[model samples]
Target: MASEWVVAKKCLYLHLPLALTSGGSFLYMEQYIVSARKYRPSTFASVVGQQALTGTLKNAIATDRLAHAYLFCGSRGVGKTSCARIFAKTINCTARTPQGEACNQCDSCRQFNENRSMNIIELDAASNNGVDDIRQLVDQVMVPPSVGRYRVFIIDEVHMLSQSAFNAFLKTLEEPPSYVVFILATTEKHKIIPTILSRCQIYDFNRISIADMVKHMQAVAANEGIETEPAALNVIARKADGAMRDALSIFDQVAASSRGKITYQATIENLNVLDQSYYNRLVDAFVAQDVATSLLIYKEIREKGFDSQFFINGLGLYLRDLMVAANPATLTLLEATDDVRQQMAERAAKLHPTFLYKAMSLCNDADFNFRQASNKQFLIELTLIKLCQLLSPSPDESGSDEGQMRPLESFTTSSPAPHPIDIPAPQPAPAAAPTKAPTPAAPAAVHAPVQPVAPPPAATAYSLGGLSLRSRGASAAKAPTEPSPAAPAPVELHRSKPYSDADVERAWGTVRRSFPAEPMLTGIIEAAVPARKDGDSFELAVGTPMQADIVGKQLATINRTLRNLLENDSVELTVAVCEGEIPPAFWTDAQVLDHIVANHPAVGQLINKYKLRLD
Candidate 1:
């Protein structure tokens, strides 16, 4: 069997590339290593974005105060597992560096690097999470290390362990052998049982920053002799969303796709990232109120295969950045290259802060309803149109159609008028005294010759024979001579009139009945009866401030109704919340009944004898 295994191994190496061929030629391809694994940190100082945590671990190792159990918790691809492996290897190294890092020259460190270490054990709890598996682990804990002082067991995804498994491993984990060390790692620490958490010292990992990822990628690019642009790397880092592993993987993909040369335009195009140029142009169109150009640009974007919702969200983010850039103090909030930020600031200067606010709000609204909108493109187009109109002048004082696109006629082209039309000058009419003409012609110049009167201004005058009037700037047309109706006269309120307390109470009752829908307000008003302090002053007594607040909301309506009903404009109503020692009469039936029964035994006995109940 040994000889056969030797022969098989020889054959495997010799025939490894036997089947790989392209174009009838043997293709000898070099082994490719992924950046994530190839560049993984091997020592404490080499780990990126976790200096504090690594320092703490190094200090613990230096002090010889390592805990029996440790929990490394963080999101995916944040170096939790890597750090655990490094810690385990460092602790097991016979000769460590002065900085408490593992010395690679040591036998244990060499074994760990070559994946032949016997002191370190890794268990994938995601797969082996049953009680039986945990029992096996507990049994394995009894054995001492053969080459190292401690046997390190690293359990990855420890939260996946079953409840029974957790319980079975709790005792062993709490009081393991002196040479045993358990390291638990999980993406979700909250899922792990509290008992397991209590037995372990927890160390949380944070998501790597974009700058760190970009710097690491730059180093990786330099090592690989690949050309890259900072903007492209920035885009890749953002696309990774704070995962260093994801960023490296994306960097590799982009590098391969671009044939070792990565540029900003190519990167964005390859990743389907909408270029900021589109947003800048859109803002220009918005400032100019160019609806047609904006719609055309939107059509072009749609043709490029961007989703409407994605476009909306991108626009919103752009507008938000613009808002930040619009103010010099808040310019630091923008995350972009200096050139891009300066350009954004320049663009933002042309836009009013109010315009940016309203534009962002419209984009947000469009994005919020995007999923439910059946005609999504129309919604997007409408949003764009609204954004365009945000900078347009308001049409009326009421602002009824503010932030809305004007009619299509507003965008239509028209020729300039040849010359400005002149408004006709006003002509005064000649005043004349009425004279009685001769009933019958006397056949003589009995009446003096009548002087001709100049015609009245055409804008408001009616001709005797024409029976028509021409308004200013309006075409000549006959209009009916109907007089407009007069407006109604305002009601005069009765001020300074005196009324009785009964009148005020009746008015309040009417007010309460008027609001049946508002049961809370009605009940409050019904309970708090109004008491007349003087002929004009009235006070409402409520049991609590909450009731007073409810009544205060309707105070205006109540006062108006009372004034009209009582025929007294001088009547004033006020609300008072009883601060302390409310009278028994104001107490609720249940409270009053309890008080009576508690204070007077006879009252309870009488009620018991009669078998009476309070309604």
Candidate 2:
């Protein structure tokens, strides 16, 4: 099928007339032209999304600084070969424009445009990629152009040439005749040998942006007498994924399907894309913490025959776009049409930035584990459930605890209600105590009731990683589910109960799990052999001050966890060096390997028997 498409595309570009047998007569039909070939750039100024490259080529031509060999590198349909053809024609034209474009009226330009010039050659290196082909090309280089000043040889898909073929062509490419200009084009630039790369002046082409693609498609539609909605064009542009040729092809496809009147609904249906409404609805469900609604939305999308992985990936991208749209500075990065962008912007305004970040993170994780998941739907559903939970407020005890999660700051609406708990006014500060690192003073006793102080009526909503799903209307029946803040209290260190060795051990074990990313720190915590002292402070025994320093940096979080787990508010942590206890960094790579081997002798035996080299 791919070969057939290639053959058909070649036939189209070649414009081979078809012979049709009419009644008692033979007739030749005009060749059919695809949009890609029909709208292919004829001049440097006509290329899309490659201004820098076009400018450089034009400048080089104007300045008369052409190189013997040139390499145009980029993905398909970014106009590498088109530019090469344009450049070749421009350089050979007898009457060129001031902007360095070829004059179509010139005999040389006319002949090249009509595919009758012998000055240019195009070789498909994918098929003719052997040393003999390179030798043939080298032989052709010795012959001067019959009509133009320079003989231009364009090699398409040049990376397919074998190493031996590349080597065979290297000498000719490096020192071609003055009249010969070699132009190499390839989608995979990295596969070309470095020797070939060094010989050519390489120009990298960028992918066409969605905006550029839309603008170009609009022009194409207008010329073709087709009517299209901006939203429909935007969908086509995105579906093209940065290839102008692809965008034009899709434009043609969509144009045919819509019968010259394209709409967004028609596009999504034809493309088999999940509806945009799913994203909007799911986002609302996420903000509301409505798990049931979110799950139902997933079911509807799944019923539409969309792949779970594809849907989840799209959801991740949607969340990312929301994150980008949430900030004014990054709004320019949102690639949708104005109406779609405006809708996204409104959703972004209501969404807390942290919530978007976490939501995106959850979706990204699910996407990463999608292939390994035992139940794909369950994985997707679990991700949605987690996203919904992010909007719910966590308990003050759990939320305030070290390593515990809290709902992201809420910004769902204009006005946010205050928490239900009555927050007492702060008391005046007492004079500082003489002791070092003196503890905060305990609050004075309060017998009277405190009132819940609300934020100003005009104030915006704010919560922790997610929004409070409070009722938008001013109705008392609909209650917000946010947890209350803790009462103002201070610790009395003197009245604190002492923790036991067993309690310390248990607390240490539980606290260390919080730093799974830092296994080294976990190991240090275990090796330190912390012992309880008579004072509030507990000491960690280690070999060096460096280990102590490492532990000290994380001391605050560690102390908080210990204090919570041990049920004591007055827990202090410090490190004391004991030289022989822990080795600093396990000395070297070999020593580290030895330690691993010591833990499991079978691994060491396997290493020795296999004669493994780590590098």
- Best candidate (score: lDDT): 1
Report the C-alpha lDDT of model 1 over 425-518, residue by residue, as the tens digit. 3433223312211122112111211111222222332322231121111111122111112312123545666655455555554665544333
Clashes of each: 0, 10
lDDT for residue 422 in candidate 1, whole number 0-100: 30
Model 1: how far residue 453 lies from native, Å: 37
| RMSD, one per candidate, in order | 25.5, 17.8
Model 2 residue runs over 4 Å out of place are 1-31, 336-343, 394-615
lDDT of 2 by residue, 1-615 (tens): 565555555656788653432231333465445688889999999899899999999999889999999999999888899999998999999888998899988889999889988889999999999999989988988998888798899999999998899989988888889998999999999998888899999999998888888888888889888888888888888888888999888887877788878788888888887777899899888866678999999999999899999999999999999989878789878886666677788778766665787789999999999999999999999999888866432212111222222222221111122222223344332333111121111121011111211221222322211211211111111111222243112222432666666666656655544443333344446443445554665555433333344455456556655665665767666555432222424343333433454445565444423323232
User: Candidate 1's error at 178, in angstroms?
Assistant: 2.2
Q: Which regions of candidate 1 fall more than 4 Å away from where they truly are?
A: 1-28, 322-354, 392-615
lDDT of 2: 0.68
